[model samples]
Target chain A: MIEEKDRTLKEKSLEKAPTGINGLDDITYGGLPKGRTTLVYGSAGSGKTLMAMEFLVKGAQKYGEPGVFMAFEETAEDLAENFASLGFDLDGMESRDRLLVDHVHIDKSEIEETGEYDLEGLFIRLGLAIDSIGAKRVALDTLEVLFSGFQNEAILRSELRRLFRWLKDRGVTAIVTGERGEASLTRYGLEEYVADCVILLDNRMEEQISTRRLRIIKYRGSKHGTNEYPFLIEEDGISVLPITSLSLEHEVSTERISTGISRLDTMLGGQGYYRGTTVLVSGTAGTGKTSFAAQFCKAACERGERCLYFAFEESPDQITRNMKSIGIKLQPYLDSGLMQIHASRPMAYGLEMHLMGMRKILDTFNPDVIVIDPITNLISAGTEIDVKLMLTRLIDYLKLKNITAICTSLVQRESTEGINAQEISSLMDTWINLRFFESNNERNRGISVVKARGMAHSNQIREYMLTNHGIEIRDVYLGPSGGLLMGSSRDIQEAKETAEIAAQSKNAARRKRELESKLKSLDAQITALNSEFEVQKEELDKLSSEEALRSNALAKDRSEMARIRRADLH
Target chain B: MEDAAQNNNGPELVESDTTPDPEFYILRLYVAGQTKKSLTAFANLKEICEEHLGGRYRIEVVDLLENPQLARGDQILAVPTLVRRLPPPIKKIIGDLSNTERVLVGLDLLPVGEANVQK
Candidate 1:
């Protein structure tokens, strides 16, 4: 017996019940303390009753734990109809003997006490309902009505305490919802009685945008996340986006994958992106950020991998049509179920709800690559810090799942100071910046690799053109003045070079003709000089012959005496 | 005169008469346990009954600690309450029945002159 007492003291054996709400169990570490009452207080339309009902329904459906919901504000039929839209068939659960919904009507004026009274009637009815379904979970929605019915605070307080104790003694996890008070946590300050756990739901509108937030005020005997989480009421039910509470223990991948654009891949160290890493494509409007992301999606689909594209600015059909204009055919992938494009306006929900919705769809689709085209649109839905925190969780979740994510963001023109885009850029593994270079009265697109964490990337900005064949990066055009030129300017420089070369050839041809004419004249003068020399030589020969003839005639007259002259001549 | 003669005979004889015997009073004292408060209340009620009602009243004691369900029938709240159940209009006095005058007033047993003056 002493050992048993010691064990109980050391272990405490406090079990927890899972609420089955997305991200809620993560924040609570499990759920509310089992067999103990938890107070959930909120104002009107703050989703206090809906949360309580979901707890019971999810308990019955998912965890196989039967539940009893005793509603004081709304009827059982009303609750059934309200929750049916969320796909929670409360009536079906009732027919299967898994749930019991009991509505208690309390009218203050109808109750009259002659002498003494306890809430034995309520106790008996609640007990019978619990026993009828063998319920392991119980929810008493809106405990404030009891205070109105019993007009005495003393009796109501004691009865509430007794009710909580009775529920604990019955060994069933119970949820007690109360309306928010002016200053206290509950209308009657019932938070003191529900000592195990207390959760507060707040609904507020800021700047014409409504946001629903939930916080766990206190939890006993267990560690829980104490942060304000945003939740959404959707077709599936309440989904809580627990930002900053998730631990950063996701696995990292080292494999490289394609970015779909081969030239862009070459710019990114010749291999593309590392698997399971975040890539940020930030650019101003009309810079083809979405088209670039679509290229990545196309590559992923061609590899027979699943891709999910979240478009906040355009519809799926619109994106498909727009991408088609750029020669990227996403229709086949969409038809083949390899790609899913989910489009919704950022104003449709708060940042955290969008995160939760993305998480839900991600879990269902289980894609290899995810794209959020222009995450900047989310800036209008929340503050910078809120968007940053949400994106951080989203990136962390994707990395943990070993899924590669490419997020595009639009930077405002004339300003490179987008706080959200800059913050997200710091968290990304690779950052690709796109801009427009205006020259020659036309704007030309340019893409530059700003940062790549673990690999070498090109530092030069490559001019890209979005032609009918898709995005193509042209080679670097170095001008004669040592500046990089693109598009029409490069063409103009090439044309100038051609004209300069043609003029130089024409001058060379004229100089060659002049040189040839001078050479011909010089050749004629040389020949005439040679002929004069020849004529002079001929005249000299003729003069010498005449002289010789005169000498010969003289020699003939003196022939007799010429024997001596001939002998001398011989 | 016949009701007066039956009431003078005995309280049991008044039970058999049953012809609107307004003189005969029936009182029930509800107690939770044999505590000092319950005993004092019982003593006080017995004394008041013998002095004021003489043999014209019948007394019954109910212990709620033994059978708690009986408290609901009369809507008993506090312990040791004296209930005047025999009269057509039932009345109750709570808290150990210490105030005899108030208890008498509550039970409609005051003298005619004082009752008329109080009214």
Candidate 2:
């Protein structure tokens, strides 16, 4: 029993080969099963050939493993030209003795079979190519052409089995691409023969928008992601956007960064956003969502940190021209190599492609912060679920890398009830809402912090104005009516208070003049009464002197009668 | 008779000495393991050669089970296949040669009118 368990564990530990595509290796844990045949089936234009070629090119270029590509559909020269746009120099790799491209042409009309035959010619050719290049990897593009070439199904089936067994015995990993069938994974049901691993590629159209998706149907002995991943085909070639690690094991940061506007910073707990957290700035049209994001980007650039700004709705030139009106000079930052503005229409590619492009830029630019202006425009490119899944992966990847990201979403004007925020609010660490508040026959911009995780934020809605000097948040005007007033309403309220103060001052001046006149009249009355009293006193004194003189004369006559009395009086 | 012919020497002969005609029929039969189909195809081919060309025909039988490496020369894909190498245009017919009319038609031995009637 113990031995059986050990054997099972060993079987589970089957080796894998790296596909060398950007996110595919992570999904398959490594890549297709190593030294085994892996069937990659998809419809036309679904990037099957490109994926196979990239696997070979990357194998030779990055992994130091030589590869042989036997194309049954396109010639080597045609393939070289086809891949030239992606900068894959097949001829160069060929000359280096690390790659071999052999085109196997099988026209049924030209081939005449007589006696017993297997696909020995093919086996010999493949064997020579592999031996010539010492290839560790082999890719047979469009392996279904054999079905058209050979009429005997039994012979074809047995030969294919032999071919796969030969490839395995040679100890070379092989990838065989097949056309998608109506009911089976491959046109000829080749998956049944080469079933070590199977990957299905699909291109679907939804609402006139096309999206390419990839799913791993089976992996023989290893644990792999079973989700359908969105893949993109661009100038760099096909890239699969695998979901990042789902575990929340990423490190968190307590450090803060400025949001460029001082008032806005104060509203977010007196500091800016967290170093590696996601911030959602949601607002309706004309609510300065782009301007707010630009402010954050400018702040990051000014601090000598790189910032990547993805503009979906507007061209880079348009963004630059519009931002200049708000006093943000992105040109300097761009010229200094601290900021990069990548602008493209949301309809230009699928959501996963956009994510892949962003990831490529992030790796090459190594930005400290990333800004997606009006992320809601991406909703038009995919379903709500697709966009949400992409954003989740993006946010998770950014967090894992310790890179701060600011995403602005344009909410519909009619749904001012926070429905848009409700969609992505749970995914963000901070949410700031902007709205157009109309008051006193004028429209004014208002900004409020909806939520800031792990920090305290102001709950008051501040009226902000987007002027030539940038965004400025105004203090709430508490009027007599008890609600915050803004725009022309605040101006009218201020004018009314000024008029009332002026009238009260005028009444005080008139009262001062009347009191001065009354004091003057009282002083004059007192002076008149004093003068009357002085005149009466002078008359009384004269009367008293006269009486004294008469008394003296009487005393002299009496002194004659009595000489002794007179002498006593003298 | 087919088993005895399997050991016949010299499979690369241009023609049999008994018939020096330039228009002689050159035939080769491929088989594996002397199966029932191989015996029937060989017997049918011999009867057709006897009745059609007589001394002007040559037959070479190759057993692929004994020599698998020779399977690549004629692009052989199935057992019990007959190849007509001589006539300017080469032809191939698969399966056991049980239907004499198809064999004759496939090998281009029947008269033009009879082949048309068979078709």
Candidate 3:
């Protein structure tokens, strides 16, 4: 028997029950210890009950492991009502024999302990509930109520210790929710008995914004994430986002994707931003940041790639309409399901909540690229330092997922904008800074690639005009002061240069015409000389014939012979 | 979801909501098994009822080992507990009920001003 026990212990080191939460499984290495009690301690309204319920429900629904939820404080009906909004059908599961719920409520005002007793009744009820569904998981939410309800501490403590032992013997994973104590993990120090695992949930309100965070205090015989993971009690269930100051180990790609504009693509080393890289587009107001992002989205959609756009400043319709004027039609991509726009007020949620929501979307949509229009607007959601940290984690997460991200930041104050952009740029793989050039009594837009990792990007601050047709990157034209000109002055300079070129070409054509006329007169003189020579030759022939006729009269007999000879020759 | 919960929970509520009669004394003795402690608790409860109120009291002994579902109705936790069901306010007394004086006071048979707070 001793050998068999040793074999069993060696074979099964430590079994786990997967909670089936998104990132929770990754952090815990699996889940809570199997066939052991895990104490979850937290203050009131700290989402302890929700986490325990989700653990039971998700175990039943996903892993086919039936569960039991024995509420110590709230009634079964109240628990059911609370879970309804989250779309967990408790009654339906109970009917399907997948779950068993029983509320153990005790009124201290009514009950009187006359003599000594043991909690055998509770044990029997709990045992019956578990056996009814063949449960593999159990949750006793808000179990601290027993201490307050019962007057016998010795008996209650003994019975609790016995209950935990019974749960382990039954080989059922159990979660016991306890209220946070001043110095102990639980108000009643239940963690002493529950020695396998302990998780703490904290809800803190900062700057009128509340954020929920979770941390694992201890996990025996396991390696778990020790950071405070922010979780969301959102629809479908509690999703614990297990993020730490993750090690820089994300794989990078040398492949590039276009920036949509042909010239912008060329400016970015005749290609564009690298795949799985973060690009920051920082500029002042009305510098066409949103338009640039939309153009990138259009190009991605044109290549049949999906893009997720998060717009914190404008509505979806407003962005679509505004992009339409720049000759970038985003409505088609939206209709074709190639692009998705999630617009929300930055301050509507806390920074952690925003990160959680974005992670959820990234998981569900699995988009190839994401565009956050004006990430600087998140300042309203959190402090500057908080925003920077969130951005850093977000950029790292995108890189780890090999997702391309384009973040637009609004430079509100000129004085501090440089430092602000630099803080975010340190995390970005490429930085494209757009500025408004005040030239010719007007504000004109100019674009420059401040930095691009592993590429020979353009260094020129080229002028880009936002026309009704599209954005046009004009050639560099220097003003009279030898500086790069832009706007109407650049246009006037280009027109003047064109007119000068036209006059120079016209003068060359006039000179060629003059030379051609001179050549024509020389040819006419040669033709006149040839015609005079022909006329002179004809007159000499006539004079020779007259002289021969006078000589023929003197020698009539010789002329007759010459006439015959001439006739024969003719 | 709320409708389903209410419908499923309707029968349990009705089953536990027995008709209330103030004059009648209804006592339920809950025990885990047929152990010595459980038998002693039953005997003591019967003796107390016979002497205090005669035929006006009705006693129901629930063996939780056999009928575990019955424990949920009275919110039973400790074994050998006596629950006063018919009284306006329900009261529970734990232990084997050997202390007759305390049992009488707990059931209001002695007409005491208040029961022991235990704290």
- TM-score: which candidate is best? 3
DockQ values of all predictions: 0.04, 0.11, 0.60
Backbone clashes, each candidate: 2, 4, 0
Interface RMSD of candidate number 3: 1.2
Best-to-worst order by TM-score is 3, 2, 1
Preferred candidate (DockQ higher): 2 or 3: 3
The models' CA-based lDDT, in order, is 0.82, 0.82, 0.84
Question: Order the candidates by DockQ, highest first — what do you get?
Answer: 3, 2, 1
Clashing pairs in 2: A115-B76, A116-B76, A117-B76, A117-B77
Clash-forming residue pairs, model 1: A116-B76, A116-B77
> Which tens-of-lDDT digit does each residue in A170-214 have in candidate 2?
989999999999987788999988878999999998887788899
Of models 1 and 2, which has the larger DockQ?
2
* Candidate 1 lDDT over residue span A82-106, tens digit each: 9997888999999998998877766
Per-candidate TM-score, first chain only?
Answer: 0.76, 0.77, 0.75
TM-score of chain B of each: 0.76, 0.77, 0.73
Please give me the DockQ of candidate 1 compared with the native complex: 0.04
- Which residue pairs in candidate 3 have backbone atoms (N, alpha carbon, C) closer than 3 angstroms, thus clashing? none
